[model samples]
Every structure is written in C-alpha cells, then in structure tokens.
Target: MQLLALQPQRLSAVVRAPASVRLVTPASGMSTYRFNKHVISHHFCANCGCAPFGFGVGPKGEETAAVNVRCLENVDLNAWPRIPYDGRSV
Candidate 1:
C-alpha cells in the first residue's frame, strides 16, 4: 500500500513517495512533528483523508521527524487498514 505524491515541491514529496500521488502541505512551518522518544506525529489532508507526511519522535530528545508511508501502514489497526486523515492545516 503506497500513497504517492506527484509534486516534488510539496510536503508529500518531502517524504519519499514511490510514485505520483495527491499532494498536500502547510503553507509554512514543519512538515514533520515530534511526539515521543520512538514515535512522532504525522499528518495529512482532513478533507481528502490522505497522508501528506508523518512526524516521528527521534531517539532521546533529538526531535521528531517524518516517518515513511510504510510506517503509517503499521499505524493502522483494522482489518481494512484504512486510517483517517485530518487536513485543517493543509
């Protein structure tokens, strides 16, 4: 399962995508967010419900960073594996 971002300049491209996909990003600020030591906060479009990018906390207090789309797949806990995306900023 891969949600590819088409534009290289968009937040979708900031994170590595396999191929062309829907693009969404914040006008400013970090595309990534920090959460915990091993986890972070990633975000996507609320309207379309797509993963624009993910933010994961780094080791110690280094800071959070974007996790791969594959990581998002792991975040899913349903038989269907479809996660809801929020897009207030995007």
Candidate 2:
C-alpha cells in the first residue's frame, strides 16, 4: 500500500471527527508488526489484507499517524504534492 505522510496537526484539520478514528483488527484475525527497530505499529485488516494506517513517533518525539490515502473516500490523491521520505535512513 502507498502511504501518504501528514503531520498530526495537518491531519486533524483534514479528517472530520478525528477523535472517532479507531484501529480495529478484523474478526478474521490480523497481524501487527514493526520494522526498523520496531518504531511503528503497522495495523492491517486480515480479511482483505489491507493496511489502512500506522502509528509511530515523529522526529520531534510527538505521536504521529500515517494514513493510507487510497482508503479514504472522495480524496483526490493527485491534488497533493508527493514528498519523498527516506524512512529507511531514519
């Protein structure tokens, strides 16, 4: 899945009812794994094997979330500038 990076501040502005967002594992069973020193918690839906989002700490130590924009409805992905992030080097 392609991941779009957004700051928590910006994300809150875009997502309505941000407080209602929750990560739920599917009843069919799903897996949560971490890579690169286990910095982020990657959540995926087992039934469809789709990763809708992930949670991790930002560079400044603030909590951050990376949401898969493709999963969002009515969002024009092309409207946003794509910024390349080299998380592997972090």
Candidate 3:
C-alpha cells in the first residue's frame, strides 16, 4: 500500500531529549555536524579536557561532521594529519 507509506516508523517525529543531558551554554558558531542521530556535541577545554569538534544528528536531523584537531590552537597543527580518533566519547 504505497510501500506501507515508506515506513521509518512511518515518518517519525517526536523530538525532545533528556535522559543523560548536559548543558553549560555559551553558544558560538561553525564546525557543525550531523550523523545517524543521537546528539553528542563537543567543544571541551574547561581547563583541559581538550576536544575541538564532535557532533551528531544526521540522516534526517541534518548536521554531522565528526571533528577533533587536538582541541585546536592558533591554527596549522603541522599541516593537519592526526588520524587515530576515538577521543574517548568526545
């Protein structure tokens, strides 16, 4: 019947999360990301937690990029090439 109306739980939409949330807002921009959906944004260094990027919400929510540049510096971390990611739950 119209391919069951293209089931994906029949066009899901019930957004509202809070079962392990964390917020310490200060908002900025750029380096956005989105992937597979689940939300897990990143931007550490609250004294030395080092993490520059790492985000979520893709395939439908739009905005996933997956990041990390040694928590960033003034730029040019040796021409960028440090692939061994798994930043322990960025």
TM-score head-to-head 1 vs 3, winner: 1
Q: Write the per-residue lDDT of candidate 1 for residues 23-80, one digit (tens) a residue.
A: 3445143343344343646564455545545544334545433433432435432332
How many clashes in each candidate? 10, 0, 6
Question: What is the Cα-based lDDT of residue 8 in candidate 2?
Answer: 30
**RMSD to native for every prediction?**
12.0, 7.0, 16.7
Task: For residues 1-90, write the lDDT of model 2, one tens digit per residue.
Answer: 232354332331122122345645442355676887676776677667766666676666766666666667797766775555544565
For residues 1-90, write the lDDT of model 3, one tens digit per residue: 011111132121111233223334432533333343347554455565544444456547665433342333474444533333233444
Candidate 1 segments exceeding 4 Å error: 1-24, 27-39, 67-90
Alpha-carbon runs more than 4 Å astray in model 2: 1-30
TM-score of each: 0.30, 0.62, 0.24
Which lDDT value does model 2 have at 56? Answer: 71
Instruction: Give candidate 3's whole-model lDDT.
Output: 0.38
Best by lDDT: 2
User: What's the candidate order when arranged by decreasing lDDT?
Assistant: 2, 1, 3
